[model samples]
Structure formats: structure tokens, C-alpha cells
Target: MNGLFDALERAAGPVTFAPGATLLRGFALEDAAALLAAVDAIAAAAPMRHMVTPGGYTMSVATTSCGELGWTSDAQGYRYAACDPDTGLPWPAMPALFDTLARDAAAQAGFPGFQPDACLINRYAPGARLTLHQDRNERDFGAPIVSVSLGLPATFLFGGIKRTDPTLKLRLAHGDVVVWGGPARLRFHGVLPLAHGTHPVTGAYRINLTFRKAR
Candidate 1:
């Protein structure tokens, strides 16, 4: 975190909606350029592809990943993989900046010393949406999830542990970051369909970087 980002974080003041969940507005603005560049490079190496759920339905979001592990799904199930199913090689190494940003955001949210080994990158074009789901595939639920948003804006759906619980609709804009853990670690969350808009950085799509300790 630089001087500018530190100021931005201070201004945002860690908006908390749950016991262990927080939203930091414009937390990544200072590093957005470099971060987006790294994202482009990672996607170029691994290539983004729509994965099929265990139910055999294809996902609307196009996703790729980086770090020691990558998240994937197919008819088999949703799980973490060491290699990109497409490239048949290890996912691109996590960028140093990504690690730094995740840890800083986690610390800001009151969970210190976070180390993420997996980063799942999702691309949402117009009409793309993610249904509410828990980040339960990880072996350790102790580690928090650090999510950064870029490109277009999207509505984030944050719900309770139960599937039928009411949800809070939070609008997430470019450069925003959300960290959830502890009691909120298992909370169900997702994104609404992205609206049609061109972003200066990502054009007509929204990009989400989800950092997790999948091992």
C-alpha cells in the first residue's frame, strides 16, 4: 500500500456488513494499472475458459487462475487443480503485487498474516453472473477470502450461511476490495449479471480476482 492507497483506505474506513466481512472502496486504485497488466499476462498464459459445473451446466463467467493452485470445475466437481486443465501446465505464478495487495486488505479487515495460494480470476461480460455459493472447497476455512474488483461495476450479493436467507445487495466498483473470513467465511456470496458498459481498463467486461488458501 502506497501513500495514496493508504489515504483511500482510510477514507473508506472498512465498511463492515458482517462480523468478519468488510468492503474497502478504491483500495486498489493506486495499483490498478499494474494489477490489470499482470492479469492480462496470466490469462494469456493460462487462457480463460468457461467451466462446467458438476450439474453439467456451463458457467457463464469465463475464468482462469494463477498461483500455486488454480480453481476449476467440470462434471466431476468443483475443486482446486495444480494445472490449468487447458494448458496442462502449472498455473502462472502469483504476481508479487497480488500477494501484497491480498495481505494488506486482509490485515485491514482485521485478519493479519494471510497467505493465499490460489487466485481465481473471473471475467464477467454483459449477462454474466455468479449464483450465491460458499467458498467451501478450500481445506482450511481459517484463511479469509480477499476479492478485488476491476473494470465495470457489479452488484454483489452477500447472504447468510443458509441458502434461503435474505441477502444484501452491495454495488462494487472498479478498484474495490472485499475481505471475508471467520464467521463470514462461510457466508454465501455472488455477483449479479454485469450491465452493459465499457470500462476504460477492461472494455465491456468486469474482472474479479478472488484470492484464497485452497490447500
Candidate 2:
């Protein structure tokens, strides 16, 4: 266990993107197995599915959630709901491991006392891309957003507050955790189209778990 922690630290540590954003590379390495297990349990309760946007277009990426609230989109709009619209039941509870890791990452990123009530899970396949958008459905932007990347690598686009503002491209790999809050809380961000590849953990797919404080 000590050796594993040492390996993870050697791989990467906290990398600051700005005053309010920090990337903790390899932060989830040790907990990857447990996290995946938790995800499996959540998916079993609430299956992953592609959702349609208000614009009447189906999202390329598949999504699901576990926590008090789950994110969903339809002709009405994108919003968080207390239950899975498809299942008509409350989303699976967020695993303790997921909660702990998110809080730890948030503290390391300079945001303490972070308690997230929603954990959005996104699955991307080859050619799947997320367009620039802000996470505004949450009631409080004061809490930081904790995002963990798993499986295949992806290029993360971090943009300014405005959609048209300049963007920075950063490559993210498995076990990476990004925490952003304060001024960076409402920053526009998105994921580039995934490339065809098979990861040792999740073959031909990339899984992202984003923890948020939503009421």
C-alpha cells in the first residue's frame, strides 16, 4: 500500500491551472478499482443512456448519475432532478469512496468543506465530444467542481468565463482529478472528441465522474 501511494505521488501531484483551479494528476490511481466498482453498482441501479438536448439533438456521450440529484436534459432544458427520469426512482446513492476522494481533491485545490450532492457520470466513445458549456444547474457555484478522469486519455478544453473566450487545451489521462471553483467555477469547458483506443481498464471508452454541489 505504501508502495502504491508512493508510485501515485511520483506519477503526478497538484498542478495549478489558475488561482481557483488545480489538476491533481494520478490522484485517483490508488482508488481506481474501488471507484470503478462503485460506478458499476450505480449503473446497475440507474443505467447509462444518451439524452436529448433542448435543441432536439441526442448527446453523443452517454450519461448517468448517483447521489441526491442526477443531471438530465430534454426538450425542456438541462437540469438536475431528484430521480432518474427514465427509472422514475431516486438515483443511486453516491459511494463513500467517491465522496471522500472528491472532498480531498477539493481541499488540495484550495476549496475546503466541499460537500457534493450530485455525481454525474459521463461515458465517451470514439468520436464522442462534449461542446463548451457551463455547469449552472447547481444552486451554488461557491462549491468547487471535482472531476475525475478514467480509462482512455482525452484533451480537455478549458475556456474563459465567456463561451467565445480563448481556451486552453490540456491532455488528461486515467486517474486525473480536476478541481475548480471561485472565479473558475463558471468557466466554460468541454472535452474533445475521443480517439480510438483501448484502455487497460475500460476498453475503447472514457469514463468521467464529475462531483457537484447541487440542491
Candidate 3:
């Protein structure tokens, strides 16, 4: 806890991308503990597992979700499902703290009236990397994507609209919240492979909570 607090105290201020993405550094500093507690409860209910992509490759990142709909992928491709495929039960409801944090983060990023119905929790261990890709599975494009980072530090790959376009590596630490919408909503983005390191709050793994309106 002390380590996390100290790190947050040293984090940089907000960063705004040209395409409308906003990174609110250390925005979740005070709420991180409660946020993590909520994550633990959600994981206990749904459990985290690596889902296979349509290409039949297993993702290195373990994932789970809470809220009205959950993002899922398999040989069939990516889609939003109302219930967890494993348990055939609805995923745990989104925690109130989680909801409030997301909404507040979005508002801070200039997207008011944000109401996310799906929160995807991704766990990344050392060497885990997510390929650059655009998020387009959701029904509404008007809503922005609010992502919260916790635990280990990560290099975020913020790319242009095209896959071949140039990308910028942004350092994201625990408590950093990034909100992207409008012109930046569909831009390609991903996380670089995590290096071997440990965080006080989450040990060696990093947890990312991505909230979206995925009706």
C-alpha cells in the first residue's frame, strides 16, 4: 500500500492525445484498494481464464467480467454475451465503486453522461502482450471506452486508425485511467509485453478494468 501510494504521488499529470483520448494519471489512486477488492469478488464469482481467439490461439492474458454484458471470444469470434459461457450464469454485477469510478473518469475526460454496461477485467502477467486491435464489438459507437490500470506498470500502444500507422508507447502505472471516444474511439490500441516486475498491490500481475457500453 505504501509503495503504491508513493508511486502515485510521483505519477505525471493528465495527457491528451490528438485523437480525443485522455489519460488521467493517478486518477484512481485513492480508490485502488476498494477497486481491487471488487475485482477479487468478481473473480471469485466468475473466475479468470484465457479465452481462445477465432484463430484458435490462446490469449496470454487471463480475463473475466462483470456488469450487464461481458466481452468474450472463441473460435466463433468476438462478441458480447449476457452470461459467462463457462457457468452459464450471469456475470457478477458491476460494483458500485467501479461504476462510480468509470463514470467520473469518463466525465473528467470530457465525455459526460457516460453509462457503461460492460466491464472487462484483464489480468496480464510477465511476457503477456495484447496485439494492436480496434474495439468494434459494441453496439453503440457513441459511447467511449474507459479503461483503468492497476498493479504492475505497462507500456500502452496507442496507434492510429490503421494497423500500419505509427504508434506511440505510453507508460501507464497503477491508478491511471484512460478514456477514449469520439475520433479516438476506434483507433488501434494494445499493451506491450509486460516485463518481469512486481507491484505492491497486485504482486507480479497487472489488472486492467475496461468499461464499455456493449449492449
Candidate 4:
């Protein structure tokens, strides 16, 4: 048992099980205020909305995007596009701080040279939730997914390939960054309904920025 545990620990990838998928605490929050400011700016330009699913159901969480590509879902289906369908305009450009954080986080997780081209920003209010789903919209699964948590905390559900597979619930706090790729690239994941809370920075909301290589 010790040998097996050691082997798993020595695996050539990110593996920090804090009773959940993985937990890397206090990764970096130096520029969190700046990042949130940038988010507010983007939101002002392209307001976040509860996008409709292909099945016509409005999502519980409000979403916006930036970078070269943005993830969108509608009757056409979930996919990455160069512009926001709501407005015939390109999504906001990826902020330099975001790009730097993603690349640095990926490198820390053992996937270096990561250059993400899409960043999906999600805002979750009290009672908002995200259903379990795989992030397969990207053209390449080789690139890792870097998710940054800000404002109110959230419970993240990380599952395996099969939906029925048992999942680990992770408590993600503000300024936490979670990176997954390689064998965990296609893992199913989602967020449970957020509990009521008030954050000084976000004011009763949870903001998540997920960076991906959409091209």
C-alpha cells in the first residue's frame, strides 16, 4: 500500500489530493484586485448574461468571454467561435495578467509553454450552479485547463470519464487556481449551487476565469 501510494504521488503530473480532485492553495493572488477590475471592464463592454443551452434552457450562471475564441452554446450546439453571437463583435482581448497567470499555473502543474487562446469568464450568484460536463469544445485536449477562482467560494465537483463515476467535491476559495490536463484533460466537472455569501471584492458573487486553447 505504501509503495502504491508513493507511486501515485510520484506520477509525472499535477497530483495534490485534498480529499477532492486536487488542491493547490494560495497559488497567487497578488493581482487579484487588478484581475477583478479588468473583469469589470470587460463586463461593462460585453455584459454577462445567462446564455441559453442548445436545448433552449437558460443557464443558471452568467457568462462572458475573451481572447481569440470564446465558448458559446445555443441551438447550434456548444462550440468555440471567434466572436460573441449576442453581438457581431470580437470578444474582449485576453488581459495580459490573465495570460501570464494561466501560463505560470500550467507550468507549475508540469505543462510548460502553455499559451491559451480563449478565456471563459463565469459569474455565479447565490443558488447558481453548473451541471457536470466535459470541456470538449476546444480543438485540442492536449492543452491544460487553468481555472481561477475569485470572490465568493464554491464547491467544485470533479468526476471521471463516466458520468456515473464517483466524484470528489472540492472547496475552492478566492485566489485559488486549478490546472488539469494530460490524463485528466477530459475529466467531467461542474460546480454545485453556490451558497449565499458576500465578498467584499465581488459583492455576493463568485467569478471564475477558465483559460483554454480553443484554436
lDDT for each residue of candidate 3 in 20-78, tens digit (9 for 90 to 100): 88889989999999999999999999999999999999999999999999999999999
| TM-score, per-candidate, Cα-based | 0.94, 0.94, 0.94, 0.90
At residue 209, give the lDDT of candidate 2: 99
Off by over 4 Å in 1: 1-11
lDDT for model 1, please: 0.92
* Candidate 2 TM-score, C-alpha based: 0.94
lDDT value, residue 170 of candidate 2: 73
Worst 10 residues of 2 by lDDT: 1-10
Inter-residue clash pairs, candidate 2: none
Residue 62 alpha-carbon offset, candidate 3, angstroms:
0.2
The global C-alpha lDDT for each of the candidates, from Candidate 1 onward, is 0.92, 0.91, 0.92, 0.85
For candidate 4, the per-residue lDDT at 71 reads: 88
Which pairs clash (backbone N, Cα, C closer than 3 Å) in model 4?
none
Measured with C-alpha atoms, the lDDT of residue 133 in candidate 1 is 95
Regions more than 4 Å wrong, model 3: 1-11
For candidate 3, give the lDDT: 0.92
